[model samples]
Target: MNRRTFILGGLGTLGVLAGGGVLFTQRPEFGRLPRGERLARLEASPHYVNGKFQNLVPVQVMNDQNGENRFVAMAKFLFGDKSHLSPKQVMLSKKTDLQTLNPAEDVVVWLGHSSFFMQLGGYRILIDPVFSPYASPLFFINKAFPGSNVYTAEEMPKIDVLAISHDHWDHLDYPTIMALKPKVKQIVCPLGVGEYFESWGFAREKLHEEDWETEIKLADDLSVHVLPSQHFSGRFLTPNPTLWCGFAFVTPQRKVYYTGDGGYGEHFKAIGQKFGGFDMMLGENGQYNMAWHAIHMLPEETAQAAEDAGAKQLLPAHGGKFALSRHPWQEPYRELTKASRDKNYKLVTPEIGQLAYIDGQKNEQFGPWWENME
Candidate 1:
């Protein structure tokens, strides 16, 4: 080929690549970064340093144990055995008509993964809601198990408070947030996560973006406390621009906690003491591996964390929906059942969309639903 012709072809290819990059960045799913006053607030936070949020204890997102780097871990997860990574048979679930429920009842409906629909203190609240069929940016990746995604944004009643734990795609879904924006009366998220909501046209007055140890009153009877989690946050290349956290909902009569994706840490005990003791603990109990043990907890740790938090009941989250790890689909349930045998807390395993009472523990019997499934 002539030199002039080769140069022209190379330039054309570069132009196309540049155009594609621009389009990719423009997608609404990418969300918006913190800027202007939001960026200033983040910078002032004690947790925010060197342009990123820091965990209470230093944590490695991917720990290199036994000479295994992140690439080796990824390769094993993608091309390894995976014989039991996904269930061969459809999982079991029960659908509850959320709008038809009595407003005076205090209950929790598991919506799969880290998503939940909870009515506490006579106010409806949603936590880390990912209603989309998949958890990742691409539809084909991290797809939810069959019969697991039974609830959608349309099925949810008007939300009194929408609480987001972080900015990861699984916890803060773009499409789901957009669909539920009209029904959400208020939004509570960790520092800097509100940038995404403001960019999507949610009113700034509705956002209660806060830092760790801060409390926001949602109603006269209910208050939401932003707590700590040993986890990292990021949607794309940059990590920790937004903070990751847990939530403790305190009413006049009861207190409940949600441990948003975190590994074993002493913060659990600290939070437990601060709140006295929780009535129930919604712990992240799946998608864990030794390679990333610094970020995600094993099933045994999930139980121990609840114990440290002085919880009487523990409901597992971050599983029963998408397969994001290499373990068997039902391993978390089996392991947690064994782990909770000697612990002080009772293990609560409810099917997707099934109601689990948060108030006095009536109708708390949930069978091992993950069993008998392929």
Candidate 2:
């Protein structure tokens, strides 16, 4: 084909792909914010600014001094070294049957990469469940590596509380949410997150949308505090219309903290001081790049955050499932294991689906399971 014809054909193909992406985002699974009262509540939040949500401290999404455009940076990351990016063999997991587990046992199980199933204070809580194979509007993008997906929607029992940290596509999965609706008794998410659930036909009463520093009494035995995470939120066309946050699950005796997804910031110290300390802290321990230093934390930073949170033991999540960054999938594990050495908190590295007792086992023996996976 002539150069002119080839260029024309390429442009046409690009147009078609872009159009398909636009339509894909419009699917009901993508979800939308509520208007009227819900919108008013969102606008009233301290984090909500003139038109968008803001982090506790200023965040620089990129630190590009070399004037590299976003498209160029994105392309480089998209096509980075394939050999170190994902495991040749899928990572391993240890199964813990959620349906049969004792709810009174106060155990926590990692469902891979920012997802958790915990029975604390006689309450069953599921956090950021992304059981779907991919973490994108388009199924082909951000596909989970083989063997990473062992638990499915069918294995989950009726959840006492579903704690969603933000509206990110990976975290607020539509297919997973729809599947869990029958089992989710109540959902407590950041301000503006309920709109998405309400759009999906979740009862307005069941949706407890909270702003930063606000306390939510999920039950007589459980109280959840919505706290700040230096992160942004959105799913489809719009961005940051919803607030992103961390959480402190307070029971009569124990406090469990979850750093949803965020960069290392002073908010961690502030939260630590506010709550005194966490018995078990779940930190976001993967998907980091210097390009977006203000959003995600590096492994060293993860260790620091654990110390700042005054955690008795730090249980790392946000890894083991998805390779959302350019780094090797197991890099976070290797780095965090080294960084947490002699730190204030014990670094707890349980294999995905293994039992992590929040209140029962404060000193669970952890080893680098991903050592040979790469």
Candidate 3:
């Protein structure tokens, strides 16, 4: 669901839709589009222009300047050699008991790919959670690698804030969201994304939707800021209807930035300067290609972005779960290990479900666990 066709593919693929007809539209996984007052609020936002929400710097979904086209990209994805795209063995991971964690401690647990469980300022925050086995509407597409889905919604602790970056199938999964709805106390999403939660029976008051650059003060010590990211959003046929964003979790003592999914841009430096630099940065460093480099970043760009954000520690995400792109599954880790050598920030690569403490002077020491896991 990270690619252009995957986003535009809708719930069903072309073959699946060719047979299902209009009944495919009835599926709840497709999610409801913004309408009524919600649509009006989206239209009023400065980011929304013409008919769609645009990035701060105008971005093309595909980089046609690199001699890439949609059809060519689609062909490469569908027919490309994918031998190394997924690990032959199950992914190595930890089984940390999230519920047993101390409330006073601040920590981050990456739930494979872009989903994360973080405890900051004594508040439990879950971002872009996809506990389901698949990232697509269908079970066959974008399936999670073996042993990658170590945590489930039922096992999750009571969530203080469930922040969603976008409406892409991988990030805003319908089944996962429905399962975690009752456990989540409050929901934070980009503009117009509240429509899906409303349609899913969540109370309007529970949803806090904000446009880019707006900050929602949750507590005296903690404030979640909706920031800019160079990405697009869509779960169905229509693209960029809802806003896509990055998030900055700020507290009096610590600061963390999560780049939901984006290419490198000045916004990284802007965010770093805005917050006086971050203690840690969780940015996307996988599922990228030259075909869509304008949207998703490469490993080298990820390192540079981390430096631009002045991050003390950089935790590379958006891999170790699914093969959304044709590159070797562990390429991001290997490339980033080298790319971050001369960078200011320490590149912290933890196994799925392992803890990355954010409160102290010392962080967990992790090795290249993906090295021999073919």
User: Which stretches in model 1 have alpha-carbon errors above 4 Å?
Assistant: 2-15, 79-81
Tens digits of per-residue lDDT for model 1 on 1-374? 99999999999999999999888877998888899999999999999989899999988888786798889988887678876888887778888999998878888999999999999878999999988888887777888888887888888899999999999988999999999989999999999999999999999999999999999987789899999999998888788999999999999988999999999999998998999889999999999988889889999999999999999889999999888998898999999999999998878898988999885458667998788688
Please report, as a residue range, the 10-residue window in candidate 3 with the lowest summed lDDT: 7-16
The local lDDT score (0 to 100) that residue 184 gets in candidate 1 is: 98
| 16: Cα error in model 3, Å | 12
Runs in model 3 deviating more than 4 A are 1-19, 65-68
- Model 2 alpha-carbon drift over 4 Å, by segment: 1-22, 65-67, 360-364
- lDDT per residue for candidate 3 within 1-374, as digits (tens), equals 47876866774586676768657766888878999999999999999999899999997887663576788887777688878999999889987899999988889998999999999989999999999898987777788998999999999999999999999988999999999988999999999999999989999999889999999998899899999999998886898999999999998878999999988899999998888888899989999987788889999999999999989999988999988888899899999999999999988888999988875365767899999698
> Distance (Å) between predicted and true CA of 292, model 2?
0.4
What digit string (tens of lDDT, one per residue) describes model 2 on residues 271-316? 9999998998999989998888899999999999989989988899
**RMSD to the hidden true structure, all candidates:** 1.7, 2.7, 6.2
Go through the candidates in order and give each one's C-alpha lDDT. Answer: 0.91, 0.87, 0.90
Candidate numbers, best lDDT first, in rank order: 1, 3, 2
* CA-RMSD of model 2: 2.7
Report the Cα lDDT for residue 114, model 2.
94
